[model samples]
Target: MPDRAPQPVDRQLPTDEARDLISLVRDIAQREIAPKAAEEEDAGRFPREVFTLLSESGLLGLPYDSEYGGGDQPYEVYLQVLEELAAARLTVGLGVSVHSLACHALANYGTKEQQAEHLPDMLGGGLLGAYCLSEPASGSDAASLRTKAVRGDGGSWALTGTKAWITHGGIADFCTVLARTGGEGARGITAFLVPGDAEGLSAAAPEKKMGMKGSPTAQVHFDGVRISDDRRIGEEGQGFAIALSALDSGRLGIAACAVGVAQAALDEAVAYATGREQFGRPIADFQGLRFMLADMATRIEAGRALYLTAARLRDAQRPFARQAAMAKLFCTDTAMQVTIDAVQVLGGYGYTADFPVERYMREAKVLQIVEGTNQIQRMVIARHLAGPESR
Candidate 1:
């Protein structure tokens, strides 16, 4: 095969339409989200009213097809909306990202009947969703999950196991649950659309997470929960692939959220430097502080570019797992670094909840862990390079 021409650098600069989304996001984030962020985060409360507002504004389904009640916007536009939301409140931004992840199984792998039954509630209303894949025994090695779903009388299956670290575990109306059906390893896995209110299904008390507090995380326990065979997404052995695919898209959302947090950190750093005077002059007037701000801005720009490039590949129906991993790893790490520097720039003030930079710093740390940790991302990238023999 001949070598292909190098693909053009995927850019993510705002278009006319993207600008309109940005304007709308800014207005809602400022007028609605920002004011409530502290109250909700402190109380570990989910922002139901804010989510209702997002649904009403058509911001919840920005990347899905318009025929499905989505905003019909491109991933680039959707990501910017997430970034703006993250800049205002990490809780809501992550909640949106998790909902999109939950929607992925139905959107990409669901049969016509499943999509018709599920997509509208997920893509149109204020309803939230949870993607249930991780379990107590499985995290990075998801193929090793032991959640079992044995066929029962008639055409039903009884699912039994615990799904750990589920976002929106208790609050979501629905979940895309992955469970084993046939044998060991990934091929035995199957994805099931389990209702939150299903019999024998219960959510544990929320975990006391270190950050992104308002976004509820808990363990979902299924003790012989019955689901119809029709609820299975794709074939019986396709759950692993579907879960991976959903995480691939979910990673891009996390990357966008990271960019938003980093952007917020950069803005806060600039504002503080310009306001806090030292040596009879604003700190921002110093070349040292100015260089740091420049670096933070540059990092955010590069992270944005990588995520958009990967998202374009996804939108165009191209192979993008490696690219998605790259974006998630780079952008999340950049968010951590930039937020740390933002705190450093403020000295003592940045360490307190009195300033938003401290909250942003705490929030950025989790981006590195969720939607496949950065370490897992590097493994995915390396496997792509190590050839077919590696896996």
Candidate 2:
């Protein structure tokens, strides 16, 4: 049967404008994103045109300033839009998040001239982006990244290093790269906006993964990639801080995406349970199955609420790093569980790719690892609660 009409989300939007924005997003997601999600994912094809469409429709830069071509939506509203897109397809939603993350350094920390020069196109100009911070040797310990950017003749910088597990690595139009510029450790890192077609910049083959194949994760190599001094973002040694600041917000994006996946899985399970026959009645009649659905729905709602709470705190200009970490941790773990249970509810069909639940399960696994591992998230939360670990 046709998939239940894009499971309704009774979002508690604060304004009619926000509600209307969400409605627009849902309409686009249901019509454009959801229909091709399964087919595109199976083909391992990144939908570049779809991203262009999102750019044209102005869904790409929702949480930034409208003067710079963003949608000027609040984080709560922006994240709800992300949830809708992710429910339709994880690649698209996560792609938007990474693009926004790439834009963050320039948007929040760039000089006024830099903003005037680059912000508009990056936001709504249909130029895809990638955030480059994780090195092959430093995934969880991001501060230990060793990609080096050295000063060169004539006020230029020469960057040479490899960035691993970068989403949209090969296809991005621009990358917000972080590289060591001073002495060792986090204090030495600096951010730069690197053009994708720079002479020495190239991406290795995409990683062969369990899921989300449509979204490329590859190693981007900067072999003496030339960047003008003007491309530098913030101070010479502020990249790590800028990267962490962006991630604090980016984690909420992941949380929203996780909730979206969980909600989709729950909807599929509910639909299957109600329709599938078990002996004399539908399987939804079984108490055990019913309770599973209840728990799934409850977790989905809780995750959504948690992310929104953090988003509101950010909108209010409050310190929300700890809350964002909690949402990321809780929501990703919930997605993993919910999708696995979704597979169980559908019996054999769920285990196979015949249904999308298996894909959802595989996709959920990466969410736990990306942005920051759930283990790292715990460390962040603990530090917030009881100060940093005593060196």
Candidate 3:
């Protein structure tokens, strides 16, 4: 469970800029974040100071535009930075991913006026952000979210309903919320930027989860919270589209995190195999164990390639929803497999907290569940394949 040094890999070629950013992130991960990961996870603590360090280092805004005080870094570079963070601590890395998801609506759909008002504080502030799309009755059925945003006096809107399973719900400064604005179904929805402190807005106590203990999850409630019309992202009926778009990008983040988790698990297994004596020789020297390591490495490499390809397509402004789903499905499943195999390699020790593989195994399960479950990803891919007439 001790923090491991970043091992140099020959295949991980990086441009000068990427090299500099990776070096900076890896240093921070080892020197600051990794040391605190175990204690924080055990206490179910959120790392506010770590987020502040990331913001000050400009890591929070890695893939955003510089015009709004962001880093303007490429997706390729941003993803590598995320991988380093996730490898050190999954909670911190996922916090960054959710924060980025919350900011995407503003960056992509907000008008100049709205962006001017919020993006600077959103990207530069110490407080994190949350994406409020799921409801008690809806998780994968996002378009069926029952939260309502009724038009109010003076061009404002009154929001009322609960957003369930919100990441950083209690800790966030702001939320990108989706609510029903018209009739039923997708066209009835609208995306709104609601301040966390706005009247009638509150979060339930954090949920006790199986893993990612350091990341707080809660239910967000909006009881007639009034927000100005200007806070609406895009037009009425655009909420579904906006939410889907944000999720496509969010899936890439999840995929990158999965790769990191797998990589961490694989690295641990490799080290243990080499050091642990089996019968008379090192376990790593056995052909059977060596083949398992080979498979784990191949799977991790494939996951990395898949996510990077999806990210490149996104950055190029191309249609990438299918690609995103593909990456998420592949990477998460790979993480699940690699983490399980990592435990097997360690025999009895892997199942115990004495080793990190057990924790990684638990953590990897949620990756398959969140950001749209693997089943949902398959549905998405099928729809893309069957064309518009399929639906």
Q: Against the true structure, candidate 3 has what lDDT?
A: 0.89
Ranking by lDDT: 2, 3, 1
Q: For every model in order, what is the number of clashing pairs? A: 0, 0, 0
What is candidate 2's lDDT per residue for 28-136, written digit by digit as tens? 8888878888888998999898899999988888998888988888899999998988998999999999999999999999998998899999999999999999989
TM-score-based ranking: 2, 3, 1
Candidate 1 residue spans exceeding 4 A from truth = 1-16, 388-391
Clashing pairs in 1: none
Which 10-residue window in model 1 sums to the lowest lDDT? Answer: 1-10
C-alpha lDDT of all candidate models, in order: 0.86, 0.93, 0.89
Give per-model TM-scores.
0.94, 0.98, 0.97
Query: For residues 25-67, could you state the per-residue lDDT of candidate 1 as single tens digits?
Result: 7888877887777767877888888889888888888888777
Tens digits of per-residue lDDT for model 3 on 55-136?
9888898889889978888776787777778888899888899999999999999999888888988888665799999999
lDDT of candidate 2 vs native? 0.93
Clashes by residue pair, model 2: none
Superposed on all Cα atoms, the candidates' RMSDs to the truth, in angstroms, are 6.6, 1.1, 1.4
